[model samples]
Every structure is written in C-alpha cells, then in structure tokens.
Target: MLLAGAAVAAIEILHRRYDGAVARGTLLDPSARRDRTDLDGTLNYLLVGSDRRPGESGPDQRSDTILLVHVPAGTKRAYLISVPRDLLVSIPPAPNGYGGGSDKINSAYEHGGGGEAGVRLLSATLARLTGLRFDGAALVDFAGLRQVVDLLGGIRMCVDTPVRSIHTGRLFEPGCQQMDGTRALDYVRQRYDLPDGDYGRQRHQQQLLRAMLDRAGETNLRDDPVRLDRLIRAVGASLTVDTNGVPLQDLALTLRGLPPDGLTGVQIPSHPETIDEVSYVVLDDGGDQLFAAVRGTRVPGWVTANPRWVTRL
Candidate 1:
C-alpha cells in the first residue's frame, strides 16, 4: 500500500510538471469549423517551424519549415508532407488586416504579423492551395528543438555523404553518429552543400524527426519519471499550440499508439523555375494529385501510384 501511494504521488507530480512546462497560445479561432466526412476522418495539422530568435519581436520572422501532418481517425498511421518553403503560391487577402499577394508561401507568415496573424494567414494559404481544412496548428521554435535533442542525450543519425555547413563551418562525415544539440541544428540547417538544395534539407529534417520519434519510442517516458519530466518541460518551452485549448499532453496521448513504421514522409511534387531572377518551386500536376489524396483520405492509393515522392528514410 505504501509503494502504491508513492507511485500515485509520483504520477501526479509528473502530470503537474508537464502542465506547468507547456506554454499555450491561440493557433485557430474558436468559431472556425471544417467538415471532415470527405476526408475519411482525417485530421490535418499545420506544423510550422519558425526561424525567429527567442524573445525577438517583429514580422521579419519566416517559417523555416512547413509540414502538414495528417492523422487519420483510426490513428493507425500518420502522414507528414513537407511543403517547401519556397513554393510559389497565391496568398489570399490576410484575415489579420495585412495585405497579401502572390509570393513564396513562407511570405504569408511574415505578412500576417508573425503570431496568431501569421498562423491564420499560413493556414489560409495552405487551405487555398490544398483544398483541405486544418483541424489545428502547432508552432515549434527551433531553439526548443535543440534543447529537446540535448535532453534526449542527443539523436543518432546517418549522413549519406560528407557534408559541411556553409553557415556554421561544422563538418559531418558520411556515416552514423550521435549529434549534440548544436551539431544537430547545424545538420538540419545545411542546404547549400546538399545536392538537392532545399529538397535535401527537407529530407534531412524528416530524418531528424524520424530519429526523434524512434528515440521517444525506445525511451518509455512513462517508465522514467525524471527523463519524462525534463522532456515535457523542454517541449513546453519550445512549442505553442493554437488557442482551441488542446493540451500538449492530450495531443501526445493521441499519437502514442503510432508506430515508427506507420509514419510516412511525403514531398509535394514541384519543378524549379526562376521568376525575375528569384528561384521558386512551382507545384506540378502531381502536387494536385497529392493534395487530392489527402483531401479524400486516399493516401494509400496515392502512395502506391507516386512511390517516387515518398521518403524512404
């Protein structure tokens, strides 16, 4: 009975610690609603990784990464589709009282004022482009990502080739290795030296995500109260969920049953074009088919047909 009481108390403490560590903000309006029946009970979440420095203010910040996560009703699997930041698209009139125009998709975030406004604009842009509605949105600051990796004692990754960061001067040899927080950040930020440019960077980002998820699976957080507490705190410090009031814990629980193999990475098909000397990725017809599959919840068939776009790593 004494041991039981201690265990119960420990669980309660861990819950409270997680609650306190998370920082909440509005990502969607409470009044907004979207039909999901056509989607075969899939929920779409716009996950944006911001480049803004901590405590920095202004509309200058841009979304460094834009991923749309599709979680089906059954929770049997999850699909992560990377929306290239440089994809050229038309931005509708901003809901946040800012002007919008045809530009790189990331500009929608900057035009929307970089907070709730930014999220709204980006959401709207994606909706316009994909014809799918978002159920919620999450913004993850890269700074917090570094801390989470550090807390995990570092994430192990395999580089395909010898790569060097143009910005950071860090070098990564081809092979599997453990990366600390700073090195991991550099690894994801290197695009110039990569053969595929931003596409290669996108693949690396997805690899990092897979690594993190695999690490989380290996480390049973429920069994390690100390590590779980620290991880929760790190996540809370770095993430902001929309104002619909879904707790991060609840979100984590919803995805807890997902297996690493069940997670698939997709790249939206596009072709590079230079407009007025500025390079941009123009979505191809395959991109439309991709979005349609997502909207209709026919991803399995879509993946079967367009296997080339799926990320193997």
Candidate 2:
C-alpha cells in the first residue's frame, strides 16, 4: 500500500490543483439504467475526447474520440472499447432541438449541443444502442492530452504502421518510438492514407491512451511530489468527468490499486457501408455479442473468443 499519509497528501494536492479545472456536467441517470448483476457490479464510463477544448465555446462539433471504458467487477482490469466515430446509430431527441434520426454516432455530441447536454445525449444514445448505461462520463480536451503527455515526460508510443502526418508533414515509421505532445496529436489525427481508415486512427488513439496509463502507473509520485502535482494539474485541465455525483477524491482513491497491465483496447466489429451518398460504419452481429459481453462483465471471455477484435497491445 502507498504510505497512507503521503497518499492522502498527494490526493489532497490533486484536489486543490484540480479545483475548477475540470468542466463538471450533469450526465448520468442511474434510475434509467439496467445494471446486470451477473458479475455483481460492472461499471461503464463513457470517455469522450474531443477536438474542442474544455470550456471552449463555439459552434457544435462532432466528437473525435468516443471510447466506452468498461470496467468489470473487482476493478482488476479495464476494456477500452473504441466505437468508430462514423458508426451509424439512432440519435434520440435532445434538449438541443436535434430531432431523433439515424446518423453517424459522433453526431450525438453535436446534436446534444456540445457540453453537459452533449454528454447526456451521447450517454443516452449509447445506452439505447448497447443496452448498458454509463455510470460516469468524461469529456476530454484534445489540447489537454498534449499537456498531460508532455508533463508526464511524454509517452512511449509504438506505431504499428507507417503514419504520415497531414498536418505537419512528419513521417512516423513502423516501430516503437518516442513522441512529444505535438507529434503525438498529429499522429492520432491522421486517417486519410491509413489502410483501415478511421479504424486505424481509432486504434492509434487507443494506443495513445494505453501508453498514457502505462506511463502514469510507472511514474512514482512519492519520490517527487512536484511532478505529482504537475501531473495532476495537467490531468485536471485535460479531463471533465461526471462520476454520477461521486467525489473525485474518493474516485481516485478507489482505483489507486489497479495493476499496471489493467487496460485492454478493443475495436468493435464493424464495416463501412454507404447510404444516401454518405459513408458510415455498420456494426456486425459480433458487435452485438461484444456488447452483451460487456453488459454482463464477460469481456475477457469475449476477447478470448474473438481474438481478432482485440488489439495486440
């Protein structure tokens, strides 16, 4: 166990520094959710990483990264399920005048008006699609990702395929390489030349997150409290989480003991299809199986059964 006193002090420092940095929102509705007890307690946290910054006001925009973080009971491990942005799903009526219609899954955020309301509508839309409601949600600013990465000494990313940056004209060759904040962001945003298109980008995004978590786990805050404070402050600026009213301090403490190898990235089974002159991703029957597994805390089994959908990382 981390020295109790030091851990408490570090958490308090995090709380102080994080004050008002994260954009809080009223997102989840517990009463409307159907929790499956097959594993006693399963948690699904919707983590949306957007191109827009936290508290940045502008015209509504589609979410860039839509990840369903499903933590099965015991909190021993997590599943990073990447829902393709272009996946076609039903968007329900929202307070933001977005009438219900079948559209790209990313549209839910825009339809919800791009804040707490956006989180709410996206949560509801996902629930309607997956049959599992979110226990908490977080809207992450893409800018914050860079800061968090750079503050923590940058992440060690492995590029499985060659990625040429359209934004900066930098070429990322196939190999494990070190990335600074700028290169990392540009690397993740490229999709045009990738063989798998958006799916490859989704994989890269998941890889970035895994690297961040792995780095965080490896970083020892007790040895350097200043680094801890800086890291927490950067994270605070990057993420806005709605933990269903749970205090952020307690939430941090609860997951403090998670093992370093806890995260597993997964891609939902889907294929690109066109309708009405629009290209969209359509889920396959296996996606229904995957969703069912997540709902019942059988994700590990599902991953084992369907190895192709699981990323090597």
Candidate 3:
C-alpha cells in the first residue's frame, strides 16, 4: 500500500506539471489584454535589474540596468523602454525607514532591499521624470536570464563583428551562431568590443534579448514539459515582484494581448556628454521627445503603422 501511495503521488506531481505547462500556453488569451474598464485604466511595468548583487558577494554593485514595458489591452502594440543605467538622477530617501540621497537611477535597488523599495524608488523617479505610472515591477538576475535561454536549448544570433573581448572571462567570435547560458551572458555583458563602451553594450544586450525571444517562438519549450518546468523554476527562483501591484495572471494577460512583433525597442536617448568632469551618456534633446511619445496613450505612428524595424533575417 505504501508503494502504491508513492506511485500515486508521483503520478499526481507529473499530472500537475503538465497541467501547468498547458495552462501557461493555452490559458493566455491574445485578445483580452487592455486597461481596466473601470477606475484608473491600463498597466505598465518597470522591469529593472541592478549590477548590485543581491545577497551575493561581489565588488560590483550599482544600478546599471533598466527596461520599462508598456502593456495595453486587445492591441498588438507593446512598448519596450530601455533606460541607460548611467543616466544621472536624484535617488529619493530609502523607503525602508532609511533615508536616501542622490544616486544613479540603477542604484535604487541596492539602496532599498530588492522588491518594494526598488520598485517604489523607480516608479517615483519615472513619474517625476517621464509622467508614466507603473503598475508593478519584476527583477531577474543573470542566472535567471541564462536559464531562460538554456530552456530554449540555446538561441541563435548573428554577430556583426568579431567579439573577442575578455569580459567575465569569455571570448566569442563574430558570425551567425547559437549561444547557450554562459555565452549568452557573456555576449550581453561585454563592453570592450564596442567603441562606445557601455552604451554599445546596452544595444548589444537589447539585440540579444530580441533574438532570444525570436528563437523561443521557433522552439519546443512552449509545449515541452521538462523544459517548461526547468524554465519556471529558474524564473521563480530569481524573480521578485511587488505583491501589492500587478498580479501574475493579470500581467500575463496583458502580455498575451500584444502580438510579439508589434513591440518596438525604445532606448533612452544619449550622446556623449561631460558631467561633473567625467564623461557620461547624457540624454540628448530627442530624449524628451521619445519619453513624451511613450507617456502618450497612443502608440507612435512610426511604430504602430509600420514594420520598418522588423528583422528580416
């Protein structure tokens, strides 16, 4: 009887696993995502990551990553806001009863513990600067990102130049190739290969991200049980969300409403500029124009009514 009971439990677990996988794919409706019809309307999320290693021993600690996503309902258009990590900004007082002062926009995560603090600081900062209200925030570490690629069995990307820079101690060549967990991270994090330094690295990272998403659509992970389990575990382990904000189901629903290709990449404007006697990537005049378009209710005609940026490859 005990042996039979163990068998039953194992079967139940497997059943639940497959059930969740199917739900993640089929449960998503591509037409129902939109701002709430009642009260305050649509939702947007500020997805941010920090160079500051959370609970990890690392000398590198600061804000060096940001991605703002806008999701509206029943539309194919989604806006991706990529804010440069080095953008100079005033960091507000710590939300955890601790005080705060001015710091880079990315350091908000490190100053406050990880979840609410980071999200609050960013939401406040963006509202003051760009007039966009965030519904919630989610944070993912490099490991989580790596696992995501691995689950898809690696992503294929074309390297425009010979990527021979030593970053995090890995070297890659230029060409069309497939990247696993380690190589993907290395590709996204390298700065020495590009002449523009961090700004170039950010552009490469965004490209890598888009490539990964493209590859995912062609892969079996969306229907494969083992892969889905591993991917979810990795994401669940590394991701933290503000519970007082957008629920996962609601967020997923919003994501489902938008056709993947309709989303266009939006990077914060920055050209080289001197700040406090140090060279930094400062927002150009086009920066305000870009953010204004993002803050507006309608998607720009350039993005919504055109397919100019589509990757034909």
TM-score of each: 0.90, 0.90, 0.75
- Per-residue lDDT for 1-313 in model 2, tens only? 5699899998687667676666677765443244432233667888888888656755477788999988877778888899999999988888667788999999888888876677678888888899887777888888777888887787898887887888788889998888888888889889987999998998898888878878877777769978777777787777777777667766666666666578788999999999999999999999999999987778999999998888865
Q: Best candidate, TM-score-wise?
A: 1
Report the C-alpha lDDT of model 1 over 170-272, residue by residue, as the tens digit: 8888999999878888898788888888888888888888888888777767788788778888888888876244455666677777788788888999978
lDDT ranking from best to worst?
Answer: 1, 2, 3
**How many collisions between residues are there in candidate 2?**
0
lDDT of 1: 0.81
Candidate 3 or 2, higher lDDT? 2
lDDT per prediction?
A: 0.81, 0.81, 0.60
Candidates, ranked, TM-score: 1, 2, 3
* Steric clash pairs (candidate 2): none
